[model samples]
Target chain A: MPQVTLTVNGKSHTVEVEGRTLLVELLREKLGLTGTHVGCDTSQCGACTVHLNGTSVKSCTTLALQADGGVVTTIEGLAAADGTLHPMQEAFREHHALQCGFCTPGMVMSAVDLVNSNPQGLSESDIRHGLEGNLCRCTGYHNIVKAVAAAWPVMHGKETVAAE
Target chain B: MYDFAYEKPTALAAAVASLAGDMDAKALAGGQTFIPVLKQRLNKPTTVVDLAALGLVGITVTADSVTIGAMTTHGEVALSAAVQKAIPALANLASMIGDWQVRHRGTIGGSLANNDPSACYPSAVLALGATIVTDRRSIAADDYFQGMFTTALEQGEIITKVIFPIPQKAAYQKFRNPASRYAMVGVFVAKTAAGVRVAVTGAAQGGVFRHAAFEAALSANFSPDAIAGIATSADDLNSDIHASAEYRAHLIGVMAKRAVAGT
Candidate 1:
C-alpha cells in the first residue's frame, strides 16, 4: 500500500491506499467527503470534479498517488464556516439550476473554477461550453447557464448578492 | 483496475530506469486516457511509473518554433500566452479537446505517446512537422507515429519535449462525433516556410496521414477553392458505428477546405 498525504478541503490526512485507488475514492471512501460523487466512474462524467491545486480536474481519472502531497478542494470546501453557500451555489439555488441535485456538487465545483479563471466575465455560451464535462440529467441546463452568468458578477466582487 | 506498485521518480533518468528495469511496467502521464483504459481492465501493468515529479511541464517559444514539455497539460497550453501568440491554431485545437476537466489533466506527450488514431495532437504534429524529443533522441513527427494507439516510442523511452515549428498560417477543423466528441473527420492545414501541409485524423484507418493532393493543391494556391475540386479516396479510411468510410472521406474534403479557409 502507498501511504499518501492529501490536504483536502483545508484538512490534512495521511492514508494508505492501493496503487489503483483513485482520488475520488480517497475523498469519498477514505475521508468520507461524499460530496464528490462518482457518476460514471469514467473520466467522462464531471461528477467527480475537484480542485487539485486550484485547478479543476476529474477525480475519477486521478490516481491517489498521483495527487500525493497536493492540495485538493472538494465540493464540501466551497461554503464558509457559518454555512453560507458560495456565490455559484447560491445562484444555483436562487435560479433553480438543479432538479435531482445529483450533479450539483460537481457542476458547482466546475463552475466556480470557470468563473475564477475567466475574470473577464463568462457569456451564456461560454458557461455552456465550460460545463461540457458535467452532465445534468435534469433542468435542461437553462437555469444552470443562468446561474453561472448571475454568479460571475457576484463572484468577482463586481456585484453583491444577499443584500451585501 | 488491477493493483500495481507506483513509483514517482524525481529525476528523468530514474523514471526511465524504473520503467526499463521492469518489462510489465508502464509510464503514467496525466492518465486522462490510461485511467479509463485501466477502469475497463483493458491494461494491467504490474508497475506504474508516475511522471509528475520529473519537472517536465513548461513551454518555450523562439522566433520560429515553440517547444512544449512532455508533462505540460492541455489546460496550460491552451492558456499559454506564448503558445497563443506563436500558434493560435494549436492553442485553439488544445482548447477543443475532451473538456475542461480533461484539459486540466491531459498532457500533450501522453496524447502523442498513446497515438490514438483519432487523437487531435498527432494531426498537429503531422501537419506542423514537429519533433518528438525523447529521453535518448529526437524523432521526427513523420517517423514518430506508426499506427492506431501506436508510436515509435520504445517501451521505456520517455518523451521529454515536443518541438513544433510555428507555421505562417494554420488552422484545424474537426467535425465532432456528437456523442464521444472524437473527431469524425478532423483536418489540420499548415502553411509553413517549407511548404503547405495537410494532416487528417479520425477518418483514416492507418491513423493521421498527410493529404498529398490537398497539400499540392493548397501550395499552388492557398484557399478553400484551391482544394475544392479534389476528392479523397475512401479506400483506407475508418468506418465504424459513428461514420462510414465514404462519409469520412467526404468529411475530409469539407474539413480540409474549411481548415484552408480558416487559415
Candidate 2:
C-alpha cells in the first residue's frame, strides 16, 4: 500500500491506497464523495471530470498516486460554505439543464473550469464546443447549453447573479 | 489493472536507470492511453515508472526550429503562443486532438511513443522531418517510426524532446472518427527548403508514410491541381469498419488537396 496525500476542497487528507487505485475510486470510495460519477470507466465519457491543480482532467483515468501532493476539487466542493449554489449550478437548476441528473456534476465541474479558462466571455457556440467532452443522453444538451451560456456573465462578474 | 510497484523519479537519469534495470518496467507519461490499456488488462508490467515529476516540459523556439519537451501536454502545445507564432499549423493540429479533457492529459511524447496508427502527431513528425531526441542520441523522424504500434527506440531509451524544423508553408487536414475522434484519414503537407513532403496517417497498414507521388507533384507545382490526378493504391492500406481501404485512399487525395489549398 502507498500513502498518498492530497488536498481536496481546501482540506488535506492522507490515505492508503493500492497502486492501481484511480483518483475517482479514492474520491468515491475512500473519501465518501460519490458525486463524481463513473459513467464510463474508459476515458471517452467525461463523467469523472475533476479539477486537478486547477485544471480539469478525467479522474477515472488518473491514478491515485498521480494526484499526490496536488489540489483536487470535485463537484461537492463547488458551492459556497454556507450552501449557496455556484453560478453554474444555479443556472443549471433554473434552466432545467438536467433530466435524470446523472451527468450534472461532471458537466458543471467541466463548465466551471471552461469559464475560468476563458475570462473574456463565452458565446453559445463556445459553450457547445466546450461541452463536447461531456455526454448527456437524456436532455439532448439544449438546456445544458443554455445554462452554460447563462452562467458566463455571472462567472465573469459582468452580472450580479443568475436569474431565476 | 494489475498491482505494480510505482516509482516517481524526479530526475531524468534516475527514471532511465530504473527502467533499464527492470525488463518488465513501463514508463508512464501522461497516462492518457497507458491508463486505459492498463484498466483493460492489456498490459501487465511489474513496475510502472511515473515520469510526471521529471523536469522534461517546455517549448523552445529558435531561429530555424522549435524543440518541445516530451512531457509537454497537448493542451500546452495548443495554447503556447510561441508554438502558435512559429508553427500555427502544428498548434492547430494539436488543438484538434481528442477533446478538451484528453488534450489536458495527453502528452506529445506518449502519443508519439504509442504511435497509434490513427494518431495525428506522426503525420506532422514525418512531414516536417523532425528529430526525436533520446537520452543517448537523436533519431530522425524517418527512422523513428517503424510500423503501427512500433518505433525504432531501443530498450529503456527515453525520449527527451522532439525538434521540428520550421517549414516555409505547412497545413494539416484530418477527417475524424465521430466516436473516438481519431483520424480516419489525415494528411500533412509542408514545403520546406529541402523540398515538398506529404505524409499520410490513419489509412496505412504500415503506419505513417510519405506519399512519394504526391510529394513529387507538389514539389514541382505546389498546388492541389498538380496532384489531383494522383491516387494512392489501396492494396497496402488499412480497411476497417469505419472506412474501407479504397475509401481511405480516396480521402488521402481529398485531404491532401485541402491541405495544399489551405496552406
Q: Give candidate 1's error at residue B10 in angstroms.
A: 0.4
Q: What's the TM-score of every candidate structure?
A: 0.99, 0.98
Spell out the clash pairs found in candidate 2. none
Q: Residue-wise lDDT of candidate 1 within A1-164, one digit each (tens)?
A: 67999899899999999999999999999999999999988777698999999999989999999899999999899999999999999999999999998889999999999999999879889999999989988989999999999999999999888663
Tens digits of per-residue lDDT for model 1, B66-166: 99999999989999999999999999899988899999999999999998888899999999999999999999999998988889999899999999999
- lDDT, model 1, position B3: 93
Report the alpha-carbon TM-score of model 1 versus the true structure: 0.99
True C-alpha contacts between chains kept, each model in order: 0.86, 0.73
Q: Native-vs-model 2 lDDT?
A: 0.92
User: CAPRI band of model 2?
Assistant: high
lDDT of each: 0.92, 0.92
Q: Alpha-carbon error at B126 in model 2, in Å?
A: 0.8
By summed lDDT, the worst window of 10 consecutive residues in model 1 chain A runs over A155-164
Candidate 1 positional error at A131, Å: 0.7
